[model samples]
Structures are given as C-alpha cells and as structure tokens.
Target chain A: EPEVTQTPSHQVTQMGQEVILRCVPISNHLYFYWYRQILGQKVEFLVSFYNNEISEKSEIFDDQFSVERPDGSNFTLKIRSTKLEDSAMYFCARQGGTEAFFGQGTRLTVV
Target chain B: SQQGEEDPQALSIQEGENATMNCSYKTSINNLQWYRQNSGRGLVHLILIRSNEREKHSGRLRVTLDTSKKSSSLLITASRAADTASYFCATARTNAGKSTFGDGTTLTVKP
Candidate 1:
C-alpha cells in the first residue's frame, strides 16, 4: 500500500531558528493537510492545501507558518522562527477519498 | 471548534475482550473517520462513516454514526494485545476538506 512519507523522523532546533518539515503525500491524492499534536494534547489542524493554495487554516497557523507544494510530490511546512511551544509532532495527511492517510510524522523539538 | 470529542480518555481491557469508544461532535459533519495511532507513531486510517450512513464494519472493527445526535462509536471486538493504541475520531464538515481531530481514547489490551 502506498503511504505518506515524512523526512527527518525527529528534529531539534534552536528557539529562534527556522525549520522545514517535509512530506511526500500519496501521488494521486489531491487534498493535503498539516496537523500538530502537542504532548498529552489533542491533534490540532494547522492548514489544508489544495489546488496549490491554502483552503483553510487555524489560528495557530499564523504568519510564522507557511506551507508549500514546491513540486508535484513534495509538501513542506516551514516555521519562520521556532518557539519552545512550537515543539510537537507534525503530521502530514493526504485525502483522495473519504479516508485520509497520514505520514509517520516529524517530531519537532525547539529548545 | 469543529472537532470531535471522544469519551473515556483511557481504557484497559483483557485480550479477547471488546473495546468501545464514543465520540461526540459539536457541529454538523459531512463524514466522520476513525484513526489509530500507536505510541510515538503516525495515525492510521481505520474507517470512515458518511453522514448518511448509520453503521459500517471492517473486519473486527465496527463503527456507527448517529448524525441526529452528532455522535459516533467505534467498537473493536475480540481485540488482541496488538490492538492497544490511541483511537481518534475526526470530523469533516461540508465543503471543508480539513479534518478536526479529538483528544483520542487510549486503549491498552492486556495479554
């Protein structure tokens, strides 16, 4: 079965540095999304991308956050300046039908 | 928030026992999906029940959606020790491809 793949299983970055989490969703999938799960907290939606544009985003997805489908296969989420609270597991998902497949996730740790 | 909230944050069951998790959402949804995540792992799509569907089953897993009550239940019958994981319910609203997830229910099946 084809599955979403994310790069850098774990990452540790400085508080003020930048970080880019990359994901390669299923090739044929159209809708892509980014969500984050804080330790001991619920998963929170960050943004949804479709047709090379952002469909929707949450308050947490402020100016510091940006998503790009720079290529046909890569979907990347970038944080301009990482904050301590930004540390969490970031998941990338793709939806071709009602069911969405998620990647293994990139664990972001900002110290 | 358009998120689904799952009940019984945690559960413990013996192998071969059945486990049931409930989810309630605050808004109308086009579809509801159940996902499983093992410790420190990515989310896996389990099942999806459309708003018009009342019940759905996949192998030993059963899901029932009650749109009138905005609630859904996921039943894992004859669960095995490997079934231990955190189950989450996600809601997708009409015209909104983004999915909002709940805190999830942690189930530990003891062998």
Candidate 2:
C-alpha cells in the first residue's frame, strides 16, 4: 500500500531558528493536512491544503507557520521562528475522501 | 474547539481478550474515524464511520456511532500483544474540511 512519507524523522533546533518539515503525500491524493501532538496531548490540526491553497487552519497555525506545495510531490511546512512550545510530533496526512492516511511524523525538538 | 473526547485515558488487557474504547464529540460531524499509533509513530487508519452509518467492521475491529448522542465506540476483539498502541478518535465536522482529534486512549495488551 502506498503511504505518506516524511523526511527528517527527528530534528533538534535552536529556539529562534527556522525549520521546515517536508512530506510527500500519496500520488493521487488531492487534500493534504498537517497536525501536531504535544507530548501526551491530543493531536491538533494545524492546517489543511487543497487546490494549491490553504483550505483551513487552526489557531496554533499562526504567523510563524506557512505551508506550500513547492513541487508536485512535496508539501512543506515552514516555521519562521521556533519556540519551546513548538516542540512536538508533526504529522502529515492525505485524504482521498472519507479515509485519510498519515505519515510516520517528524519529531521536532527545540532547545 | 470541536474535538472528540475519548474515555479512559489508559487500558490494560491480556492477549485474547477484547478491548473497547469510547469517544464523545461536541459538534455535529460529517464522519468519525478511528486511528492507532505506536509509541512515537504516525497514526494508522483503523476504520471510518459516516454520520449516517451506525456501525462498521473491519477484521476484528468494530466501530459503532450514535450521532444523536454524538458518541462512538471502537472494539478490538481477540487482542494480541501487538495491539498495544494509542487509539484516537477524529471528527470531521459538517462543512468543515479540517478534522479535530481526541486525546486518545492508550491500550496495553500484555502477552
């Protein structure tokens, strides 16, 4: 079965540095999404993308966050300036319709 | 803010036993989905139940939805040691393209 894939399974960055998380969703999927989970917390939606634009975003996806489909296969989330609270497991997901598939996630750690 | 809340933050069951988890949501939803995640990995789609559908089953996994009460239940029968994971319930609200996830119930199936 084809699955979503993410790069840099784990990352450690300085508090004020910028970091970009990358994902390659399933080839035929049209809807892409980003979600995050603080340690021991519920998964929280960050943003959803479709038709080359953001469909919706959560409050957590504030000024520091931006998402782009820079290429046909790559969906990227960039955080302009990281913070300690930004450390979490970031997941990329794709939806064909009712069912969605998620990548293994990238664990971001801020120092 | 339209998130699902699952019951029993943790559960421990022996192999060959059945495990059941429940989730309640605060808003009307278009669909409800169940996902499983190992310790630090991405979420694996387990099953999806539409708002109009009352129940769904896949393999040994069974899911029931009561939209009137805005609640759902997932039952995993004849569990195995490998079934140990965190289970989450996600809700896609009506007319909302984004999904909200629950805190998740951690199940530990002992051998």
Candidate 3:
C-alpha cells in the first residue's frame, strides 16, 4: 500500500534557527496536513494545505510556521525560528476523502 | 483545539480480553478515525466512522460514533499481545481537512 513519507526522521537544531520538515504525501491524495505532538501531549493541528494553498490553520500555527507545496509531490513545513517548546514529533498526513494516512513523523529537537 | 480527549489514559488486560477506549470531541465533525501506534513507529489507520454512521467494524475492531454527544468509542475484541499499543481518536471537521488527534489510550496486553 502507498503511504506518506517524511524526510529527516530526526533533527537537532539550535534555538532561533530555522528548520524545514519535508513530506511526500500519497501521489493521488489532494489534501495535506501537518500536526505536532509534544511529549505526553495530544496531537495538535498546525495547518492544512489544498490546491497549493493553506486551507486552515490553528492558533498554534502562528507567524513562525509556514507550509508549502513547492512541487507536485513535496509538502514542507518551515519554522522560521525554532523554540525549545517547538520540539516535538511532527507528522504529515494526507487524505483522500475521509480516509487518511500519516507519515512516520520527524522528531524535532531544539536546544 | 478541536482535538478529542480519550478516557482511561492507560489500560492493561490479558490476551484474548477486550479493550475499550472512549473519545470525546468539542466540535462538529465530518468523520472520526481511530489509529494505533506501536512505540516510536508511525500511526496505522484502523477504522473510520462518518458523522451519519453510528457504527463501523473491521475484523476485530469496532467503532461507534455519537455525533449528538460528540463522542466515539473503539473496541478491540479478542486482543492479543501484539495488540499492545497506544490508540488514538482523530476528528476531521467539516470546515477543514485537518485532523486533531487525542492524547491516546495506552493499552498493554499481557500474554
């Protein structure tokens, strides 16, 4: 079965640096999303992208966060300035209607 | 903020026993999905129930959705030691395609 794939399974970045998490969603899927889960916390929605544009974003998705579908197959989430609190497991998901698939996730660690 | 909250954060049961986890959400949703995660691996989609559907089943997994109450439940019957994992409920709202996942229920099936 086809699945979502994420690059850089684990990343360590300095505080105030920028980090880009990349994902390649299922080829035929139309909608893409980014979510993060802090240690011992629930998964929080960051943003949704469709038609190469942001469809919706949560409050947690502030000025520092941005998502881009730079190519037909790549969906990337960029954090302008990484903070310690931003360290978490970031998952990229794609949906074909109701059913969705998630990538293995990129573990971001900022120190 | 539209995330579901799961009850009984952790559970332990013997092999062949049934494990039930409950999730409650705060907003209207288009569908509810259940996923299982084994340690640091990616999430595996188990089942999805539409808002109009009351219940759905797949093999040993059964899911029920109560849109009016904004709650859902997942029951894994005849669970085996391999079934030990963290189960999470994710909600997809009608307005956007993003999914917000719950804290998850950690289930340990002892052999």
Candidate 4:
C-alpha cells in the first residue's frame, strides 16, 4: 500500500540549532499535517496544510515552526532555534478522502 | 484543550482475549480514526468510522462511534502478542482533514 514516508527516523541536534524534517506524502493525498508527541504523552496537532498553504495551526506551532509543501511530493517542517522542550517524535500525515496515513516519524532530540 | 480523551491508560491481557478501549471527544466530528504504535515507533492506521456511521470492522479490529455520546470504542478481538501496542483515537472535526489525537491506551498481550 502507498504510505507517507519520513526521513531521518532519528535526529539529534543541539539547542539553538535549526532542523528540517522531510516527508513525502502518498501520491494522491490532498491534505498534509504535522503532529508531535512528547515522550509518553498525547499526540498533539501542530499544523495542517492544503492547497500548498497552511490551513490551520495550533499554539504549539508558534513562530519557531514553519511547514512547506516545497514540491508536489515533498512536505517539510522546519524548527528554528530548537529548544530542549522541542524534543519529541514528529509525525507527518496525509489524507486522501480516508483516514490519514502517518509516517514512521522523526524523533527529534535537542540537547 | 485536548479534543479527545481515552480511558484506562493501559491494559494487559492473555492471547486470544479481546481488548476494548474507549475514547471520548468534546465536539462534533466528521470522522474518528484509530491508530496503533509500537514502543518508540511510528503510528499505523487501523480503522476509521465516519460520524454518520455507527460501526466499522477491519480484520480483527472493530470500531464503534456514537455521535450523540461523542464517544468511540475500539475492540480488538482474539488479540495476539503481536497486537501489543499503544492505541490512539483521533478525531477530524471537518473535511479540512486535520486531526486531534488522544493520549492513547497501551495494550500488552501476553502470549
């Protein structure tokens, strides 16, 4: 089955550094989203993108975060000046008139 | 505030036993989806039931949604050791396709 794919399953970066997480959604998906889960916590919505622009975002998706559909197939989330609290598993998902399919996730660790 | 909340943070059962987890959401939704995740791993989509649908089944997974009650239940029948994972319920409030997820219930099936 087609699936959403994310790169760098594990990422370790230093505080105050920048990181970009990449995802390639299913070929025909029209909606894309970014979510995060802190260790042993709930999965929280960060942002949703459609029509090449962000449709909605949560408070957690503040000035430090940005999402882009840089191409037809690639969607990316960038965090500027990462903080220790930013450490979490970031998931990419896409919807094609069905349930959203999630990527393997990128575990971001900020030290 | 979180949109969905699931009960019984964790469950343990023997192989062949059925496991049921319940999720409650605070607002109207277009659909509710269930996902599974292994320890420190990515999420796997399990099943989705539209708000207008009462129940849906996929393999050993059964999902029931009650729009009036704003609650949903996921039942894994005759579960196996391989079924051990964290199960989460996510709600899509509109066709916009963004989803809000619950904390998830961790299931441990002993072989």
Candidate 5:
C-alpha cells in the first residue's frame, strides 16, 4: 500500500504568523488534497490539486491560504497571517481510484 | 452547500455487536466513501461505493448506497473497541471533484 506522510504532528504558532504544513507521498503521485477539521467539527475541504495545478478550492480557502509543490516531491499548504480560528487538524490526502489515502495530519494550534 | 450529513451524531455499543451509520447528501454524486478517524489522527479509508454500485464490502465493513434517496449506510459487524472512532461519509460529484465530508458519527464500542 502506498503511504502519505505529514511532518510536525503538532504545531503551535502565534496568531498572525505564517505556517507551512507539508505532505509527502510515497512516490511522485498525482491528485493531492488538503482538508481540515476543527476540534469537534466536521472535516472541511480546503483545496484539491490535480496534475500540477490546483483544480478547485473551497471558499474557506481565502487569500491567506495557498498550496504548492515547490520541490515537486513535497506538497505544502501555507497559511499566511494565520488566525486563531485556523487552529485545526490539517490533513493531506492522495486520490486513489474512488477513495482517498490520508496522512496522520498536522494539528495546528494558532495561539 | 453542505453536501453530506450523518445521522445519530454519536453511538455506543458493546463489542461483537453491529454498528450502522447513515449519511445523506443534497446533490448528485459519482461516489460515496466511508472513512474512520481515530481520535485526533488522520482519516482511514473504509470503503467506497460508486453511484452505479449498490453495495461494497471490505473485511467486516459493508457500505450500501442508494442514489435515488441520496443516502448511504455503513455497517461494521462484530465490532471491537478498536473500531471506536469517528466515521465520516464523503461525496464526490465527479471523478475529479473534491470530496465533501459529513459531520461524522462518533462510535464507541465497549469491550
């Protein structure tokens, strides 16, 4: 089975600071996604990237948020000027057929 | 719009019993997927049922989809304490559409 790994299992960032969460797939995989779940809340879609470009993004994904594969091997989500409300578990998923394989997630605590 | 919503926000059952979770969506979907999240961990794909398929099974997990009703059900038989987690249902409108996840059902199985 293919694997997806996320770095910094837990991160505490000050509000208004910038943070980047990274996801590394087992190989040069396609169809990357970013989702988030606030404590005790639903898992919300942030964005999806297919091929080499972003295919779609949710309204919640404002200008403060951006997804990039700067190294072609690591997919990253950067939050600029993060807010307290951005505190959540951010997950990176890979598209596999009709299902998705997810990483352990990066728990972002914007204090 | 919120696409998927699960019923019975929480459930508690004894080990060896079967636990069922239902999910309803508001729009057309190409596939519905079930995922399990243990505590604060990332999601684990449980099963996927395409719109053209009625049911799918993997291990002790069984998922049934009813497109006419825009609903799906996930059944875990002979459950164990390890099965206690939040189960979420997600819908994808197209093969490449971003998945919309539901609030999820918190299942607690006592051993």
Candidate 6:
C-alpha cells in the first residue's frame, strides 16, 4: 500500500519562533488534510485542501496557521509563531476513495 | 466538535482472544473508517464500511455498520500483542473532504 511521508520526524523550536511542517502525499490523491494530537487528547482536524484550495478548516486553525501545496508536489503547513500549546504530533493524510492514508507524523515541541 | 465517540475508553485482553470496540456518531455519513495508532506513532488505516453496507471483513478484522442506530463496531479476531494500540473511528460531513476523528479507544493485548 502507498503511504504519506512527513519530513523532520522531530522538531524543536522556541516559543514565538516560526515553523513549517512538510508532507508528501500519495501521488494520485486529490484530497489532503492535516491533523494534530496533543498528549493524551483526541485528534483534531486543522484543515483540508482540495483542488489547490482549502475546503474546510477548524477553529483551531487560526491566522497563525496556513497550508499550501507549493510546487504541486509537497504540502506544507506553516505556523507563523509557535506557542507552547502548539506542541503536538502533526499528521498528514490523503484521501483516495473512502479511506484516508496517514503519514508517520512530525513531532513538534515548542518550548 | 467531534462527530464519532468511541466506547470503553480502554480495553485489555489476552493474546488469542477477540477484541471489540464500538463507535457512535451524530449526523449521517457516507462512510466510516477505522484507524490504529501505536503509542506515539502515526495512524494506520484498518478498514472502512459504507453507510449503505451492513458489514465488511478484512482478514481477521470485521466491521459492522448500523445506519439506523448511527453506530459502528470493529472486531479483531485472535488478537495478538502487536494489536495493542489506540483505535479511532472517523467520519466526514456530507460533501466535505476532511474527516472528523473520535476520542479513540486504547486497547492492550497481553502476550
């Protein structure tokens, strides 16, 4: 089975610093998404992108967060300024048919 | 908010035994998907069942969907130590590309 790949398995940044998480989804997928899971918390949806635009986003995805499929190959999520609460495991997923395939995830630690 | 809620927050079973987890959701969904996450790792797609379908089977795993009751169940036969992980059910709102995940059920299979 094909799999999504996320860069920088672990990231550590200071609070108020900027960070960018990158993802390479399965080649033929048209739909992409980003989700985060805090320690011992439920997975939260951040944003969904389709056809080069955002289709839906959650309240957690505020002005500090942004996603783009630059170069038509990689999907990147940028956090303008990091916060301690921003520390979590960020996962990238892609939808092909009815199911979604996820990446290994990038563990971000904002100190 | 989350659409699906998994029951029995946690479960522990001996290897070779069967493990079952249930999920309840609000609103109608085109399909429901099950995923597994091992500790701090990323999620792995397990199976998917459509609302119109009653049941689906993949290897030792069986998934049942009851659209009328707005619920679904996953059964893993002959569970093994490696089956220990957190299981989550996901659903997408009508016409939306992103999926909403449940709180998830933690399962531990003792060898």
**Which candidate number has the best DockQ?**
5
lDDT of 4: 0.92
Candidate 3, residues A1-111: lDDT per residue as tens digits? 448999899999999999999998867667899989887777788998888888889999999999998878899999988999999999999886688888999999999
Per-residue lDDT for A47-97 in model 5, tens only? 999887988999999999999998888999999999999999999988877
**lDDT tens digits, residue span B9-73, model 5:** 99999999999999999999999999999998889888888999999999999999999999999
lDDT of 4 by residue, B1-111 (tens): 467888779999999999999999999999999999999999999998999999999999999999999999999999999999999999998865688899899999999
lDDT score, candidate 1:
0.92
In order of appearance, the predictions have TM-scores of: 0.96, 0.96, 0.94, 0.96, 0.96, 0.96
lDDT of 1 at A64: 98
What digit string (tens of lDDT, one per residue) describes model 2 on residues A1-111?
A: 548999889999999999999999867677899999998888999999988899889989999999999877899999988999999999998886777888899999999
DockQ of each: 0.75, 0.72, 0.69, 0.82, 0.84, 0.75
> What overall lDDT goes with each candidate model?
0.92, 0.91, 0.90, 0.92, 0.92, 0.91
- Model 4, residue B95: displacement in angstroms? 2.1
Q: Considering lDDT, which of the candidate structures 1 and 6 is the better prediction for this target? A: 1
Across residues B1-111, which tens digit of lDDT does each residue of candidate 2 receive? 346999888999999999999999988899999999999888999999999999999999999999999999999999999999999999997433677899899999999
Candidate 3 vs 6: which has more DockQ: 6
List model 6 lDDT by residue over A1-111, tens digit each.
448999989999999999999999857677899999998888999999998899889999999999999988899999988999999999998887767889999999999
Candidate 3: pairs in clash: none
Candidate 5, superposed: residue stretches over 4 Å from native: none
- How much is the lDDT of residue A76 in candidate 5? 97
TM-score of 3: 0.94
